[model samples]
Target: MKRGILLIAAMTANVLLSAARADEAAVRAEIVARLPESVGNIAITPDNQLIFSHHPFFSPEIRVAKLTSPTTFQPFPSAEWNTPRKGTYQYLDNVLGLRSDENGVVWIIDMGFRTNITPKLVGWNTRSDRLERIYYMPDPVTRTGSQPQDIVIDQKHRKFYIADENIGPGGDGSHAAIIIIDMDTGRARRVLDGDRSTIPEDLPITVDGKDLTVSAKDGKPSIIKVGCDGITMDVRSEWVYFAPLSGRSIYRVRVADLNDEKLTPPELSAKVERYSDKPNNGGLSIDYAGNLYLTAVESKLVGVIGADRKYSTYLSDAEMVWSDGITASADGYMYVSASQISAAAMFHGGKGENKAPYLIYRFKPLAAGYVSR
Candidate 1:
């Protein structure tokens, strides 16, 4: 009888151990607000505060919010300058792309051609109450009047790397170039121009027991599009890493050659290297150990690309579909916004509209220090 009791106790202990092993820790910051619209980009400041950008269709303009605390976020008191009259000169269209400098200045890029105008980029001063330094993308990167998607700022060099996906506006696979911006002089240059670095991947979905989707952007029964959605500078800042939503492979290139306009297209293409395999990935971030984090799209997970370029799950959950706008902090957390952007009408076979009320999430790269026996 004692042996039977001991066996039952051992089974119970094993079950509990397995459960603990499968558990994941929560972020210190909570999902305080589900924005009425989709927030596509985010950058964490040194002060532990989060500066985010958001906009709704046919909206007034892009709005910025500052997190007062981990669980609370409110608009930065820039009402006077963000208004239509005083701030009318700034980009009125989609501010989908944003990046912050080491000095804490935030750069906002307006895709300019959202409603009626052509695509362009803009800048903002985080130290000020409103967007004080707004400007258009300089010439080299805008040869074909390109579209700006994501940006990464280099504080040491006073430059910004802009990813021109060129697939916007019912896009038909236009130019694929990375624009290097000189913040001090407001100049921009095109690098890796017309290189086949990025390819399209279909948005795979299972609905009503079948793959229900159509290509609204391409007018075909497909979901793939040439993309350059998320970008970030590595810890060393020597190379830039990026991936596309429809891309099957991840690519990176040295910043030194990218900044130099003298390199030819084929030469620049040779410099490009495949980084990883990320489907439906909308964002890229790096940890202190050089592992790359990607939004695993339908996987509802984040995969870390190691130094060997081998991938592993840093964190994942079944509810993680449509994750977007991810960034890593020096402290150890890789923050990502959990927005089911793929389930949107546009992402499927319906209208190209994204559903709103987005949520933010954070995960620890190293196992939670205190979460063990």
Candidate 2:
């Protein structure tokens, strides 16, 4: 009887493992669009129009673009907005993160690192094809080296939560934080600055058997570290999920607590809950069922943290190099951008190994998700 019991237990475990593999295999990545330059992030408008940012790392002349065909794109909103003019904040200086809301407003975050301009949020109305609003993030709200890369729009609360990685010019990821903006009043404030939750772990990220590094101030190679890079909200907009690009864990806090002005910094910090362990990641998006999907950069895969707080591989591809941004669409698919950042020249003795035709791929999620998120 003891031998029979052990045999049954082993067989049961094998069956469970097989089922898990089959589930992952069912979700395959399908190519959505191909571009000559690397893509930083993606957002699909309510009308199903796809929009993305040409990564600032390469200094592309066309900063923001809309896909007109699978292999072609044009300056988004207008060519004038993408053009930079001296002593003016009217144009997009640098952009990385953007999202479309339920009402068809596409919001883009301009980090302004390229020209030292004031970092700001630009919102364009897709339906009207015109400018809607701009919220300037001046000093005290944004410090030197503030690279606000990702954004989470809460239409229900009329607020915008931005993830500032603090990894640019004068930044070394030491002072990462989340900036909150009031949609109605255009008021913005920095929160959780330098908190343990907003900072990167000391862990070094390795990709393709090589350590990802960049030139330090001393002109020596140093492992790249980024803090508070990805941010997202659940379907209910009750909790804000976030993590560092070089972090080993994901953390979140109640949306109410974060917006409550009465709470002190210590009080707000105490409310943050460590959600789950994660690999080094870039962007985050959540499904209606509360499963948080992450762009697992180092592993060349997309990972999901279920409502039960368990992390698992949802989909993967050997060609999926440095997946940077991800967003759920109304068509019941999750879109991802393969930025190929690790292969960029900066990490390879200034000899760029990045190939053209950077890709955007999509896969089905466990549950339906909003397009704006």
Candidate 3:
């Protein structure tokens, strides 16, 4: 009789475990906002306000914007900040990556690709509705084709890690690396330049049965390869995770080693660990439990690499054309943007195929997440 009871208990436990797994796999993405312009990235202020960048690939009139309603938005910070003034670096030129810290300060990375000026990081205090700071990234720190796309803010250590995907004019993923900024001193350094882990793997990114290609300077067709695109820091700020947009793996290094100026390039490179295999991804975020969330651009889905280093699909939708940027919100949900980059005119041979009403989606996460991370 005892043996039979034990068998029944085991069966009940198995059924409960299976049900929990099924519930987790059933998480669905719900549309939070729809806009006429494609969204480049997404961030949420402490007060739960949605802020996003208008994808620069299409040369948007408004560089950054904040949601006024579910379907409407206005230029963020101000309209003047989005307008380009000749010979001045005060306005936002081209912006992509942005994130809001716990204090409600939204840090924006302006590529400066439009006017060919110095790239910079701009911080706007959402609470005060004022400009907080601006850090210039000049020649040596940024290269000829340096497009600093994504940023990871480590407030605990007063540092900012930026992923520079050298896909600009003279950049062809050859000069890709991480730019470490010391928030305290306003100093920056380019580390792991040309490292294998930071560069793209020789792979083609295909979308909707077509390989994405770009025209070279000589009018030759070449695969569009991007490097060091996605970047995120753990809740503890111990490690910064990053991966190339055209590569199939994620890599990370200790924040301590990256901040140690005494460490040589080779030494820093040696410290990088191949975290997990992933699809070609665009953005990254993390939960407090250490699970890394990735915007799997190629698959039209959001995937999570758990603390155990296993990757699994978290949420998927047919409308998620190019899941560009993702962030963990204070509301216990993860938000992502579908930029529809594959339908852009440049990829479709100069005839913009993207439909209006690009989407921003949110779904519950496995664990609670930090807003600053």
Candidate 4:
């Protein structure tokens, strides 16, 4: 009978839908690593070697590490650099921004806030397992209210683009800008000071169905503000894209304009463009085919902005909370770390509630070749 056939077709469609979702879940994201609490950043080299950084905002142990296996990480370079008691001469202070270039070199931006330190860059040759170079930021540059949060390396041009989140000691984030460093000459420049694109307009950061706020001295929840947290460079190394963790928009500018010292900040600001509307996110990554990946912090999703500037949800999982650093690897995988920052004790009264075994996830990128590695 016609009615019986209709029922069978409906049942078949339901089965097919279930199968499709199961297939999607199969490759949603593989749990590549686990930690005790949270990590600030994650980078994978072209050879699929993993490197991660510990955010100075929390514990200072293991400022940088290399994944020997899925769950084990060895302090990258050595334990001295990760230990505060090792004396400040040849050790790392604070490292947040991390990147692995195509040449298998890992670059770290040490904010240098430990003891009395100088902000600098430490490059490690992964192939040789040795420190390659160190470039210290001049006093004038670091004094310009620098709070480097993330970095993007332009290997083709031998330059580095750093995002200054600008959150001060008192938890104020009014100052935000991009710092450019020349790898060849060790010269650094801060651009777009106080510009609209660099500054994060006050906005609520919601996570796990609750707005992330600051805990007052009296245990009251207050608004939390952050600026210019994530950044990335295009495939051709011609453009840079960035976004604020508390913001819902993505911005971009030409590298040519950023490198030109003759132009004033105001003039350079004019060259920056508001690229697209996005969700609150912690990291931005671009693939070689020009697709931009955003780590959606609130919705527990990974959003993608295609060449058309249209936003779409690429992956969604309940486990991805406070999805922090994201890296598009040349191996066709995009890796993300779930720091669960909003659940930390500082924001939840005096008691910390961060659960152990924090997770890192990775999925195949939309297209092939990634920008850096």
> lDDT per residue, candidate 3, 1-373, as tens digits?
7534533554454344333442267889999988999999988997899999999988999999999988999999899999999877999999999999989999999999897778999999999999889998998889988999899899889999999999987898988999988888889999988898899988888997788988877899888899999998876689989999999899999999989999899999999999999999999988766677888887899998875576778889999999989988877788999999998888887898898899999998776566766
Clashes of 3: 0
In model 1, which regions exceed 4 Å deviation?
1-33, 55-62, 67-77, 80-88, 117-121, 128-132, 138-140, 143-145, 199-220, 347-357, 367-373
Which is the better candidate, 1 or 2, if ranked by TM-score?
2
Q: In model 4, where is the ten-residue run with the lowest total lDDT?
A: 17-26
Query: What is each predicted model's overall lDDT from 0 to 1?
Result: 0.60, 0.87, 0.87, 0.77
RMSD of each: 10.1, 7.5, 6.6, 9.0
In order of appearance, the predictions have TM-scores of 0.77, 0.93, 0.93, 0.88
Candidate 2, pairs of clashing residues: none
What tens-digit string does per-residue lDDT give for candidate 2 at 257-298? 999989888889999999999899999998666678899999
Residue 13, model 4: lDDT of 45
Residue runs of model 2 more than 4 Å from their true location after superposition: 1-25
Pairs of residues clashing in candidate 1 = 201-246, 300-320, 346-352
- Which of candidates 2 and 4 reaches a greater TM-score? 2
Question: lDDT for model 1, on a 0 to 1 scale?
Answer: 0.60
Weakest 10 consecutive residues, lDDT, candidate 3?
Answer: 14-23
What are the per-residue Cα lDDT tens digits for candidate 4 across 47-94? 888888876668557888878876788898789777766435577778
lDDT of 2: 0.87
